[model samples]
Target chain A: MIDGGYQGKILRVNLTDHVVKEEALREDWAKRYIGGRGYGTRIICDEVDPKVDPLAPENKVVIATGPLDGTTAPSSGRVMVITKGPLNGTIACSNAGGYFGPMLKRTGYDMIILEGKSSEPVYLWINKGKVEFRDAKHLWGKLVNESDQLMREETHLEAETMEIGPAGEKMSMIANVMFNGHRASGRTGVGAVVGSKNLKGIVVRGNLGVTVADHDKFAEAVRATREILAQNPVASGGLPLYGTAVLVNIINSTGSMPVRNAQDAYLPEADKISGETLRTRNLVRNEGCSDCSIACGRVTAIKEGKYKGEHGGGPEWESIWSLGAMCGNSDLDAVTMANYLCDRYGLDTISAGSTVACAMELYEKGYMPAKDAPFPLRFGDADAVVESIRAMGEQKDEFGRLLAQGSYRLAEHYGHPELSMSVKKQEFPAYDPRGIKGIGLEYATSNRGACHVRGYTIAAEILSPGLDRLAYEGKAAVTKFLQDLTAALDSTGTCLFTTFGLQAKDLAQLYSAATGFDCDDKEFLKIGERIWNMEKLFNLKSGLTGKDDTLPPRILNEPIPSGPSKGEIEELDKMLGEYYSLRGWGKDSVPTKDRLKDLGLEDLS
Target chain B: MKVLVLEPAKCTGCRACMDACSFEKSGVFNPLDSRVNVITFHEDLMFVPTVCSQCETPYCAQVCPTAALVRNTTTGLVDFLKEKCIGCKQCIVACPWGSIRINHLGKEIIKCDHCSGDPACVKVCKAEALTYVEVEDVVASKQQGVAQTYRRIAAEMVKGVNP
Candidate 1:
């Protein structure tokens, strides 16, 4: 048995055979991989075949949390859902913050591996050591909030739930798995994989405690880090006061907000839908995830519009941009309503809004037939924005089904795939790569395709004092370093926001105290480097190559039309080769055997 | 004497207080063992962090068969003595607010002792939802909060008439 930070059990559920078995967690693998994304990806790489279809029964979903989960370590409540994603058939891992991760840890298991497919719709109810597979046929078509309530009524009242809505039920490629009906594992169609298995959701509750190896040391580490976070202006002041929507004004001022499907990089009236505006008009209160002190979550309501009384958790910075500026709509009410719809229907807001923006462009350019659209699909039409979200969520019509396939497929069908503003068939987020150069490199090299959280170079390029947003020099090394560090941090079950105040050494201190492992900053970062290489190897085996590592043509070729970054374009080619060299990859962007062996992955190579 | 004051509007439902309390009491992190609990009503967007009120006429102390639950006059806290108690669970059943609960192991009763007069929950509460302050200061601060709201309303009235 392990000393602490692990329950030493892995729960494996085979839906096909209806078997629930408890397997001992591999101690050696736990030591090396750590947990969450790292350990979950290791299991996937070992058990799953790269060539298998992502929606097939052979594709397994590993729901994992790290050693810090359930501990008093600040914001240590993130859970990762790792699988062969249906979005691009890549190894996808999406994490969300809530009570689910800590509750799962209390269930006497470090991870839950879901295998095979069920003949009928079902949900898993895990109460401490007991596991129950219950029929969910009656609840199959319910929305996220309704299903969450129903599942909890069936199980314990206090049980934490993770479920999907109609998007997942229909296996939309941009589906999300929502926890507590609000927090989303919101990328790369992990929800579609869950739906393909005919599993509706999982409810978990337990009474066990998570013990640390050194209690005094862990407490001291937590106290120090908490003080640091409390003192940091971004963490304690801006975030709690205005929420992440604060970035709307900050990024817009920098001319990187990606307005109107990235036809332009800035919106002149951006502050109308910014964080400050949201707070003054719509905010009811601030909320937070479990164990988090920096409560950046906005509990907002539309008070006096047609969508009045519609309230929910957030339309955070990315969602605000995607639904507001990307659609060329300055109506905050419409944006907030659409954000609620995305969460309720279990859709990834970034992909959903971006896809709609592409459709609008297609319609406006006369590429898409007027007969194909239910109404005039024009930019800045608030009603159309709301209607389109409803259509995509419910799949109400033929046009809705087409839109649900995501922007890449939708744009390709319209005969101008270049208009999709995406990389590797996944849509770009709020930031325009043309304005911010380092983030462009990150999006190109991201294992999960065009994701911001994989490596947020924006922290360096825009938020912090390190790098210039418009420059191409020195971006390669920063991107690589941030990517590696992020890979490790995501595994630790801590919020990425913590990095604003806490450094690598602080994280190492917490991890070492909890797990009884003496890890310094260098070793901690090395573990992250190992995970990055492992993910790259998985992508290579799945047939992606150096040629696939590229930004959208629009970002690389077009200059911002107006604003502070009016003449800027992303110089990705200048950074990619240097990034590859820094990562110890070959010129073709593949990890060398020597680097794999150095990371202790010789056998896999 | 000091009392634990809970301001429900300020709680974010992070449950850091619960984790701190449980760890200080049991050396492990579990909300089930926590003396303080943040009850969440997600639909209403409300969180109430509940703790023992340490009532002057303690129901738990009166109900205890062995007098294991007693009110400490110095700290104004309801102290639980494990050694003096039998596992009768009378105090658990008699608690009107349900502040007292059976341990996770179902062996004995557990209630907030205010961390022996230095509450761990208050120190870690970043939201300041839970504050341990002198009893006399609590009402004064609460009244000041209401007066500020009235002052804002009166200023708004004046501006409306002038504009």
Candidate 2:
């Protein structure tokens, strides 16, 4: 336990043998990994064989909470679900902000590792020490919400559940495991890994509270983090007020918002799904994930006709842009509805929308016909966006099956892979990297394909928090620094939002206080660097090359059609060299001997 | 009549109250064991918080076979008298809110005693959903909120706002 916090035991569930084991967490691994995404990625990379098929039962699914979880730590409600991704064919680690992370820790486990496929559909239930696997045949065909309701009814009362939908069961390459009230461990096809194991969901309830190593010290450290957040206008003010949807208009204004399938970097109708619109129209309430004072999770509603009586979850900035502008659809209700459908179907809305947007481009260029597709699928058709989301979930029709595989493959199937926007096999998030040069390099170098959370360079390039690297000249250095810092934060089990309010050193203090390790500040940054390198090493071992570290053709070649960033295509090669130089990598992008030695990884190979 | 003054609209569903109650009573984050509880009854993604409404002429205290509960003379708040109390769970059966709980109590009836006036539930409420208010003022604001919602709908309809 953190001197006075929760015990550091990982609960391992072997579905193949119906065994629940509690393994002691390795302190060294914990020190290096931190928690949540960092810890989860490390575990999956170390335990699961790289050669294993993404959809095979041999791949292990790891879920973990970070160190700051279950405490009074601000925005520490995020949980990470790590696995081999069928979408990118590499390490897939996804995270979502919700109550589940702290709930899992309070449920008396620092992590939950699911291994081996069950012969039949099964859902694991944990109530403190009592654990059991029940036949989930009845829950098999149900949607995420229905599964949760049924599980709660069967369990004799309220239950916190994580359940996959039909997309997951179908092993859709872009599926997700949805939690209560629509929180999700989305993207990178982690749900497919769970689906491959015939695992439906996990239900948990616990009676434990965190105990930090040193109470006064932890309290002091935690207070410092709060102080940092208190000063950060973005976290304490902007996020808590508008949620992430605040980024819609801001990014659009800055020409960073992706529009018309990343071909354009801005859309005029972006205000339709902007945070201002959400506040005036859709927002019902603000909810937080576990331990988060900054309740960024919004409970939204579509109050009018068509999408009325349909609500909950959010059309957050990414979802708003990805489902709205990227698809060439600017209808607010349609964006909200599409997001709702993705959540219910337990699919990654970003990938699902990107996939549909790619399909629309294909259709426009005569790659696929409107009649052959399930709906009158067009770029700006809001109805088509909603229908296609359903089609992806059902996975019955031919095009639906292809769309479920995500954008990269969907475009490849239609003979226009160049039209798809992704780095490494995964679809892109909201930003059009052509506008923000550093972000393009960040996307390319991300271990888990195209992902914004890998390194939120927008903080520097767009927000210009401390230093601005808007141009490509010094972007590589900043990208590497931010990635290392983000990697450290991700591992520390702290919220990225906390960074807006606090610093890396503050987070380090929390870790040291909570764990009673007397962690040096310099060592904390080193921890993040070590975690990033280890994941890179894992991907490298799995046959990824420096060539895989490149953006889509759309990003590299096409000029952004409009906005302040017009005529700019990402200058990736120039930044790549600088990024490599700073990261202590050779020309080939492999970790150098000094780098490996720095992270104490000389014995790892 | 001590009833939980609830503002569902204000509830963030953070469950800080859950931990506060458990920490004081059970020394853990045991929702099952905590005397005071909160639930997020979601409809249209709305968070509805439910807690013990210590009733007047209390159904639970009135029905208890043992004199396990008594009202405070000044606060007029219903409270658990652990002394001269047995773990018969009669109060648990009689309470309408399902707020009365035995919670593994061996020989004492457990209930919210308002933490001697500074209700722990109120102090730590992240959403400010609950308050141990004075009896007469407990419900006026909730009625105002409901009326406001309807007024908003009526106004919006007249404005001819399009979907």
Candidate 3:
């Protein structure tokens, strides 16, 4: 039996059969996987057929939280949405921060397994121990904010919600599950999977207390951890003051801010869309997730513009870069507006913006016909960017329909898949791999495909005690270590930002105190390695091979045009080979049998 | 006497105070069990942390037939005596700010007793949205804040006229 940090219950809902079953959480699995992404993905690997179509009825979605969730641990309110992602056909786990995860845990369940497709639109109302399938026909096509309000009204007033918007209802490949109508589990088409199941949303409220095994020890651990966070310049200063868009100018200065579909890595006017600019012009207030101290979330409004009076959660650094510089548009207002629309529409801003950037590139190159676009789809056309997002969200026209399919499909349709700036058919985030080499490898090998949160080597490559961003040497080991560490960290139901001040030992201390596990830093990272190898096995079973572990040709071939890291190109091959060896994987990037045995994951393999 | 003062403008809606309070009181983390609460107004971009005012003439103390709820003169706290509570929710209803609540188990009334003088909520609030301060200081701070705002507005008006 688990001592603490868990509700010790799992809710399995079969939509097709209209069955809601409650089972004891598998203590064995909890012990090994920890929780959140690790525990959720383990369930997927065990239950889901790797070869199953991601959007099919056979596929399942696991909504999971860690032992630390709802606890005093700093920034511990992350929810992981795990599934076979439609976007890249990979094992996808998108982590989101909001009250939802903690609220779900309070409902006496650590995880919710959504299986089979509902015949009609429906939402789950989980009020403590009781679960009900509520008809959501009225909420089917509503925006996330509207749905959130309606869900609250239908359930408890204080109920937390996770919902998909019109984009998800239409099964847009770039759709994401929006928590509290703003925070997004925003990658790899988790929302499309929900839509395919006709699951509109989930409303949860609970009054139960979450206790830790060693309460005083846990409190002490939290105090120490929070102190570290308070002292760290990035965690206490940059993040809270400027929000995440603080990275806009920082990354640009590194000459790795992907611009104009990554045709350029730098933009001279990048500061116009930066965090400092956002604060001065658009910031309404700073917001934060449950139990967070950093308060990096920005609540912004577009005042005195065409999109004036438009207010919402964020244009976070990635969103700003994708919607701003990636399309070669420096209009901060347009970017902010576009970000707000994406939130309402429940679209992944990175994918939506990057896809629009891809379309703009295609249009400029004459690959995309002018008649296909609503307006001149040119890079730097702010109006066009906003229009394209609307069209894509609504799937309004033929061009909109194509855009909904994500950049890879859209670019492939235009017979230039190379222009997608993607790995595994998912759009790359803000960073230019040519300028920052390790992240390219990370993007290429991320289990969910082209994601940054999986392993943010950028913290090392660009942030404090910086590494040589252009160097190919030592990046492989650094990338592998970070990936393993992040895999474990993401599983802990904590914000990735906490890593700015926290190390494995700090996290392990919190975990041990919470769950009565005597987990050391070394053992903690081993668990991460196990989770990583488990994901690799799942992908391997899903037919993703070492050949698929690659950066886009543009990143590998093209040198950065100009700026601080001018003439730099990602030497991916030099690092990837070393990465494979370090991971105890074969040349084909397949985890060896002996390595699996060592990690005690042989049974999984 | 020190009272729990809240600055809604400084609150980021993190609910750390709630967690800290709940853990301190009940040895668990649950907002439902917390004496302090952070109410979020998402559209307005505001968060207001609410707690027991420990009113000078407490309505909860006034309404209690059993005198289970009484204001402690020393601490300025409207303390809830559980043995005498009788599971009566009169204190909960009497609380104007809804600061008093039933325990998660619905067995008894729970309210802020100022964490026996060193408010746990205030200690955990990194944003400094919550503070335990002398009542006079709260009013003084508010006046100072208002004065600063007026000064800024006056400066802006002068700039407008000069331009």
Candidate 4:
């Protein structure tokens, strides 16, 4: 009996039996967990076995959209996709923003649970209150763009779709699920899990309208939130003008750009692959997700040169860092081409580029011979980066196979596990942990393997320049608070970028107005803490311990060689004890029974 | 006279304009219900906003059998009148831009009516992709763009011969 801000329907599709079941969304769960990532993690923890193979039929993939979705709330377009990650063997909660999320919500369901594996390639077509399992043999090997066009043609409707490309079909661990053909639920190998289910795509055409509890109150809350977003420089000016790639020169200047597979922290030619360069040379225009005032999505083009006419949504800040500085490639055109191909082939650009960087390091170290690679692999080889990404997407050869296993395995194969620059079998994003100590702690303690979005301390540490990023003293508390807030925001189905301008109180106001739930600031933060602990409980049950909450030896031991943070190693251990204590976790990094009882997560424990 | 103008180059294809238009017009947030459409050319890395040109001789108004589509003299917009609409969709078939859409309940075929002169789409367009400007200014701005391209080519030619 969900009242407002919810469709009150949970649609579960069992691929094995081709059965579609509609069940009542639990009101208690909705009130407690909210929705989106909260709904996903709880459902996955209940349904999936800890020891089950991520790609196995027993595993379930839950797609959850929160109450604010399909509403006029600014940037409330994010959709969370939760599953066991094939890459890191951890609970994966990946969020993607685009039209697909709103459309999915409009289908009169708050969540869609995908269960079992289909024997043949198939796609789910969900219209308003009706679900159909359609044959997708024709769309199996097609890339996202092509498959999207095909699906639209087949459906004869302007359907919002989430599709996978060749990379996912081939089961690349770095594969990502693409929404609206470009925006992706990218991290932790969610696409590979979809591939394992033999699901080609999910096309949704929703005609029903989403209604609010009190339209006037909701509108006022949205107005206040949008006003904050409009006034914030990062949200309104820098983001809209330069997209996320605006961080390139700034992060590079701080010596946290992670150049040449963390061998160096700065790229000499950083400006060449900067947001300023992209705006002047390659920018087609700035776009945004549905109802997003901060149009941070870059539509860029390679106007001339070798990779001429190549264009796509981005190589955002992280992608640019992974494909450019980290690989020592300064050519913006090459980076843009790699970005397009990654989107086209449905590959996670972060893992794809980071793995290539690892291989480049292996090649330079004389560990990976030239004969083993399709071409001579070297740092700053722009064309090599472009081709290798395509090769990895297409699973080109033995080289492609090696690259598909991701950096951890690739570096381990060369007998240098420490050189992989990863944690928990997942590659780290652009930020070098050594330069930003708070980020290092966040990465180590992140429930998911190494990821920046889980808790983006960069906003305070480097981007805002408000905090002492070099000192690790009070960062643990900051990191833990951010992580909880982020987890809660992820549950609310809003883009994490909104935090740049609006605070938890703003979102809480919006939530209460939309759903008629009377939640104060304390209750809001508590909900976030509860969600974070629930995820930790799931991980603990899955056999992850305090020992697993750690960064790689390179990030912890190696001093950043150049730039502002020169000769500084990450003090992760200094923060871990505080972080664990603050999180109400024991010395083993597991939530104690008493702590779980406090959050009402004792059942999960 | 002023008219809604679209600069495809300025569009990021975020669909904020679409969402706002739909919400304002229909009291709901749905991209498909928006009067304006954003056509994404993903491979080419471009977004072309397809909006009502509000032409002098609108095909939609001309094709409407019931005179539901009539030009509003004040705003120079071909506004839709719900009372006169027969739900025949003749205007939908005739519009070249495909900007007209059937409302969620399938009652009226609605297009951009400029919201009685203060267009919601234009008001929310952050990229300035959609604007309401005098008709002559639109052509003047376009010509300036063309002139700049020609001037650049001419300068290049002069440099090539002189050097």
User: For this target, which candidate reaches the highest DockQ against the unseen true structure?
Assistant: 1
Rate residue A414 of model 2 by lDDT: 73
Across residues A525-568, which tens digit of lDDT does each residue of candidate 4 receive?
A: 88888999988877777778889888888888888888877898
Clashing pairs for model 3 are none
Given the true complex, what DockQ would model 2 score?
0.32
**TM values, all candidates:** 0.99, 0.91, 0.98, 0.93
Give Cα distance to truth, residue A133, candidate 4, Å.
Answer: 2.3
10 residues in a row with least lDDT, candidate 3 chain A:
A464-473
lDDT of each prediction vs. the true structure?
Answer: 0.90, 0.78, 0.91, 0.85
* Candidate with more favorable, higher lDDT: 3 or 4: 3
The true-versus-predicted C-alpha distance at residue A68 of model 2, in Å, is: 3.0
lDDT of 3: 0.91
Q: Candidate 4 — which residues are off by over 4 angstroms? A: A369-371, B42-45, B51-67, B72-79, B133-163
Q: What is the TM-score of chain B alone in each candidate?
A: 0.92, 0.73, 0.88, 0.83
> How large is the i-RMS for each model, in angstroms?
0.9, 3.2, 1.1, 2.1
Residue A14, candidate 1: alpha-carbon lDDT: 100
Supply the TM-score for candidate 2. Answer: 0.91
Sort by DockQ, top down from the best: 1, 3, 4, 2
Two-way lDDT contest, 1 vs 4, winner = 1
Better of 2 and 4 by DockQ: 4
* Tens-digit lDDT track of model 3 for A1-605: 78899999999999998899998888787878899999999999999999999999999999999999999799999999999999989999998998999999999999999999999999999998798999999999999999998898888878899999999989999999999879999999899999999999999999888989998899999999999999999999999999999999999998899999988899999889999999999998888898999999998888987888888899899999999999999999999999988999989999999999999999999999988888999999999999899999998789888999999999999999999988998998999989898999999889888988888889999887768888888888888888888888888899999999999999999999999988999988999999999999999999998888888888888988988878888888989989999999999999999999999897888
Which has the greatest TM-score? 1
Per-residue lDDT of candidate 1, residues A1-605 (tens digit): 56788888999999998899999988787778789999999999999997789999999999999999998898899999999888887889999998999999999988999999999999999998799999999999999988998999999888999998999989999999999888999999889999999999999999899999999999999999999999999899999999999999999999998988999989999989999999999998888888998999888899987999888889898899888999999999999999999999999999999999999999999999999999999999988988999999999898899888789999999999998878888888988988899999989999999988888898889888978888899999988888888888889899899988888899999999999987888888899999998888888898889998998888988999999999898889999999999888999998888888889987766
